[model samples]
Target: MKKSTLLIAALMTFGTVKADEGMWTLYNLPQAVYRQMQSEGFLLPYRDLYESKDAIKNAVVNFSGYCSGVVVSPDGLVFTNHHCGFEAIRSHSTVEHDYMLNGFFAKTLADELPNKDMFVSFMREQKDVTPQLESLGYSRCGKDQQAAMVDSLQRALTDSVRQIDPTLHVDIDPFYEGNRHYATVYQDFTDLRLVFTVPKSMGKFGGETDNWMWPRQTCDFSVFRIYADPKTNGPAAYSKDNVPYHPQHWARPSLEGYQVGSFAMTMGYPGSTSRYISSYGIVERRDAENTPRAQVRGVKQEVMRRYMRASEAVRIKYDSKFAQSANYWKNSIGMNKCIDSIGIIQQKRDYEARLRQWQDSTGFLKGQLSFPLLEKLYARRQERVRTMMYWRETFRRTNEFSTRAMQLATGMEVKGPKKNAAKKYHSFADNSNEWDAALDREVLSVLLKNYREHVDARYLPKFYTTIDTRFEGDYTRFVDYLYTRSLLMKKGAKLYYNTKAYKADPGVRFGQDVMDVFYDLNEGMGAINDSIETQERYLCAAKLRMEADLPHYSDANFTMRLSYGQVKEFELGGKPSGYYTTPESIVEKMNRAAHITDYEAEPIMKELLSARDFGRYTDKTTGQMHLCFLTNNDITGGNSGSPMFNGKGELIGLAFDGNWDSLSSDINFDARLARCIGVDIRFVLFMMDKWGHAHRLLREMGL
Candidate 1:
C-alpha cells in the first residue's frame, strides 16, 4: 500500500482509559475523568482544577524547557530537582569552589548567582485547535504537507499572540499523534538565579545505588528564583539591577502528612510515552532501541565513576555529567527487565487481537490493508532500526568529540564558496570547558571500541580499522595519540574556537569520518523512518476510530498534563512494600555505604540524623521525620521535580523517580505496579530550616 493510506491508521497505542490511564491535558479534561478523580478524593472543582485564573496549573512552569518546576514563594522562588539544575551548579564550580560537592546557599539578594541561558516558561493558557487543523483537510494530506500546514497555522497563531504582547512565548503543540493540537501560551522569564541548595550529600543522598529502586530516601530538591526588571516587573535578561519577581500564583506548601490511601495529584510536563504503540514496535524496542544505549553509556559511566571516586576535583568536574549519563543507564536496565517481567509485548499482542475484533464489529476500515502494515513495516526495517540505533548511540551520542567535528564540517559548509579557513568567518560553536583530560579520553576510546565491534563493516568509519591495525585495537593508545596531536584539545580548555585548528584536529578528523558514515546510513534509514512514522500515525487514527465514542487521552509530548492517583503500595517479590520512609534510613544507608563516595554523607548531616533531631517538621502519625513517600500517581521523565499535591491542591511532596517494576509503563502502564516516588514536603522543610538553618527563608515561606 502507498504510505499515504497509512496516515489515518493511528490514534494512540491502545484503548481509551476508563480510569487512571492518561497524562490528561488540564484545559480540556473530560468531565468523566474529573468525576473519577473527585470520587478518588480530589476535592477541587473542575474549573479551579484546570481553567480558572488562579488554577494550580498556573503555579507549575516548564523549568528551562527541560524539566518541570513549581513556583513556591511569592517572591518567585522556584523548586525543582537538584539534578535538574546540575548544569548551572556545575558551570559555576571549580577546583577551588566546588558547588557540586559543597552546595551554595544565597543568604541575601546580592549573593544569588545568575545563569546566562537558564530561563523558566510559565504556560499562561492553552486552547484546543484540533478543529482548526482538521479544517485544513489533514486526512488527505501527506506527512510533510500536513507538517507544513500545521506549521503555517501555528506561526500565524504565535504572531497574533505576540502582536498582543510580544513578551509572551507562544508554541502550538500537537496531541494524540497530531489528531489533536493546542495553542499553548507562555510567559518566559529569562532572569533566574541560585537561591539555596542543600549539599550533594543531602540532595543526591542515596545516589545511583537507589536511583530507580524503591523504599527510598533521597532529598532530590533544589531552590532557584526568578528575577524581573524592577520598573516593569516583567521578564528580562540577566541584570545586576533586576529584583526578585513576585509571581501571580505560587504554591502554598502544606505540612499535612499523607498515607497509603490519601489522594495525590501531579501537574507538570511529562516528556513522552509510546503508551499505545503497536506490538511490533514493542518487540523492536525490546530487542533493538534500549539495549545499545545501556551498553554505550555503561562504558562511559564506569570510566567517569572510577576517576570521580579517585579525586574530589574530578568528582566536582564530572558529578553532573555522570548523573545525566547514569540516569538512563539504570533506566534502560530497569525498563528492559520490566518489559519481559510484565510480559508487556504479549499483552500488546493480546490487545491487538481485541483491536482486530473491534475493527470487524465497528467496520472502521472495512478491514482492508490496515491489518498487518504495522507488523510488516517493522519486520522489514528491523535490521536498519538496530543499525541506526547503534550508530546513533555509539557515534552521535557516546563520542562527545563527534559533535565538535560536525561543527567543523558545518562551519566550512556555511563558508559556502570561500573554500578556505583563512577567511574570517563567524563560526557559532560552543566548546564546554567542563571537560577533563582523563574523562574525555577514556570515554572516546570506549565509544570507538563499541563502534568497531557492533556497527556494520560498510557503515563503520575507516578510522576504526586504522586504529585497530595500527594500535592493535588499543583504544587507550589511540585516544591518547588523537588528543595529544589535536589543537582542539588545547583550545577547548580555554573555551575558544579556531577554524584552521578545528579542521586540522585529529579528533575532529575522525569525527568527520564517523559523520560521513552516519550521513550515508541516515540517508537510507530516512526513507524507512518516514514510512514507519506514517504507519504509526495512521495506527493511532485508526484506533481512535475503532473506539468511536470512548474518552481518549493524548500521548505525552513534553507539554503540561495532570495525572491523579492515590498513595498506595504494591507487592514486589512476594513482599508488600510500605509507602513511606524516614530520616533514620538515611543514617543507616550512609554508614553502610561509606566506602562509596556517592553515598557518603557529610559529618554534620550524619550527626543530626543519628541524634534523632526530628524537630517540629516531624510527622505526628509516625513521630519521625518523613523523608520520602510512594504513590501510584503516573509520571515519567520530564515529570521530575513536579510538585505532588494533596486533595486540597496543597504542595505536599516533589515527584522525583519511578520504581523499577513500572519502567515498562511508558509503553504499557500497569496501574497496580506503576508508582511515583516523591520527597515529602516536610522533609524539605526540615532539611532547609533545621539542617541548613536558613530561618529567614523559612519565615519568607510562611513555615
Candidate 2:
C-alpha cells in the first residue's frame, strides 16, 4: 500500500519525463481550477451564510450523479449512470422479472422503490486539517502506521460534530493527494429510491465492446430520487409517505449545441488515476506490467466468454465473475493503447521540454532540480524495480487463514483499557461480521497450498514458503492449529466473529495449545512490517515518493474522478484525427453487434448520412466534429457518470470515458489526448426528449 513509486534521474541530463505548466499542480488550486470554478458558479452556494456545517452540506448535496437524471420538479431528481445505480435497480429486480433487462418507471410517487445503504454525499465545508493532522509527527509514524493516526484523528473530529448535531455524518477526504485532508459532513439520507431507467438494450446501449470508447451512441442513464423523513430529519427507508428532496438548484437541458472550450465542472466521485508518477514507472507499467496483465486477463475473458456461449449452466455460474474480469481486461488494453500512442508519448516529451525550459529561466531551480535527477534515480533502481514487479506478479497470495490468524492474535491487544483501542477493536469486529468463519478457515488452507506452488524458488531463502518446509513439514498442521486456537478465543472473546466460533466449536480441546505457536508466527510477519530498518530503507522512501508525486497524480481507487475537455479535431499518426471513433464505440456495443440495424438509426450516423447536417460538425483542419474543452480539471475512472457543467452551472455533457491514446495520461498529464470525452448534455437531453419521448420530464425541468 505504498502510494508512491521511486524513479530517479541524474542531475544534469534531460529526463524522459517532466512536469510543466500544462501539468498544473493541485496545490496551486486557487490560481487555476478553483478560479474557474468560482467564475463558473461551481463554488458551493451559501458560502458565507452557514457555518462550517452549511459549506459541507452544500458540497455533499451538490455531488453529481453517476447515472442520468434531471430535476423533474423543483425537487431534486438527479439522473446518472444506470450501472451507477445498478445496486438500487437490482434491489427491485426479481428472477421472474429482471428490472435491468426490462427497465422500470415510476408511474406515480407510490411506485418508486427505496434502497437501503444508498446515500449521497453533499460537501459541507473545508478547513485546514494540516496542523491537527501534523500533530501526529511523521517521524513517529511510518507509512503503514499513519492509517491508525488518520483514523483516530477522523474519529475525534467527527465525534465533536455528532455530539452537537446527531443528524450530521462526517467523512474525511484527501485532496491534492495525501498532502491535504478535509472532513466532509453529510446529510446522509439513506432513503434513496429508484425512479426509472431504460431497458438494458437502451441503457447499456453498446455493451462492453463500446463501453469506454466514444463518438458514441447510447442512452447510458438512470433516474433516482432522495427521500427524507418529514419530522425527524433523519434518513428513512423508502415509503410511499416520504417526500422528494427539495434541492438548492436544478439543470436546464440544452440542444442548440455548444461550442468547444466551454467552462466545465465535473462533480462526482472520480476513481483514482496516477496522473503523477515517475516516467520510468510509466515505461515499466506500459511495456512490461500492464501489457502482460492484460494478456492474461484477455485470455481468461475469451475462454470464459466462449464457455458462457456454449454452456448455459457454465454461463450462469461465471457470468458475473466474467463481467468483473472484463473491466480489468478492457482497462488494461485501453492503458496499453494509451501508452503506445505516439500522440501521448509526444505530450510526455513536451512536458519534459517545458520543464527544462522553465528550469533554465527560473535560475533558482536550475541547479537545484533538473530532469536528469529523475532519470538517474530511475536508472539506479532498474533491477530492484524489476525484482519487485516479479514478486508482485508471482509471489503475492491472499491466504485467508493467515489474515484470520493475524486478526485473532491482534484481537487480544484490543482488550486493553484504553478507550480508543477498545473502540477501534469493536469497530473492526463489527466490520468483520460478514465473513463466514468456517469457509474462511477452509479458504486459508487452500490458499497456503496454492501459494507454495505458485511462488518462485528464488524467494524461498528470504522467509516462509521454502522448499524444505514443503518437503519436511505437515502444512495442514498450521491450518489445524489456527482453527483450534481460534476456538479458544471464542470462549470469552467479545468480538462477534470470535463469538460465532465459540458456538460452532465442538470443544474437543485437542491441539489447542498450538494456537499460541501460530500467534508467534503471525507476530513474525508483523515484525516484517514494523521493522525499523525496513521502515527507513524501503517504506519511508516509498512514502516520501508518494507525497512528492501526489499533487500531480489522480486517485485510481475505482472510485471516480471527472476529466473535463471539449471534443477537438486533431492530427495523429500522419492522419487527420477527426473525432476518432470505431464501430466498437457504442456504450451498448453488444447490442449494436446483435442488431446491426440499430447502428443505421444512430443520431451520429443519421447526421453522417445527412451530410448537410452532420458535415457542419466536421473540423476545419481534421474535418471532424470537435468535442473539445479547455480547463484545469483533474479526472479518473469513477468519474464516468459525472456531469460536465459549464460556467453557468448548466449540464453541458456526461463524462463517459477517456480516449485509448491517453491511458498513460493518468500517470502523466498528456493534454494532447487526455481530454475527458462526454456525451454532450445536449445529446443526453436529445435522447431523452427526442428519442425516448420523455417530454413530460423535460417540461417539468422548464426546458
What's the TM-score of each model vs. the native?
Answer: 0.92, 0.63
- Which residue runs does candidate 1 get wrong by more than 4 Å? 1-18, 366-369, 397-400, 412-432, 492-505, 595-597
Candidate 2: lDDT over CA atoms?
Answer: 0.49
Least accurate stretch of 10 residues (summed lDDT) in model 1? 7-16
Q: Candidate 1 lDDT, tens digit per residue, 428-504?
A: 34444556677777878787787677767888887877687988878899888887876444542321235566556
For residues 616-686, write the lDDT of model 2, one tens digit per residue.
Answer: 23334444333322233445566656666654446655555655555555665655555565655544554
Choose the strongest candidate by TM-score. Answer: 1
Model 2 stretches astray by more than 4 angstroms: 1-29, 32-73, 135-140, 143-145, 174-177, 232-234, 283-292, 307-321, 340-567, 572-634, 686-696
Clash count, candidate 2:
74
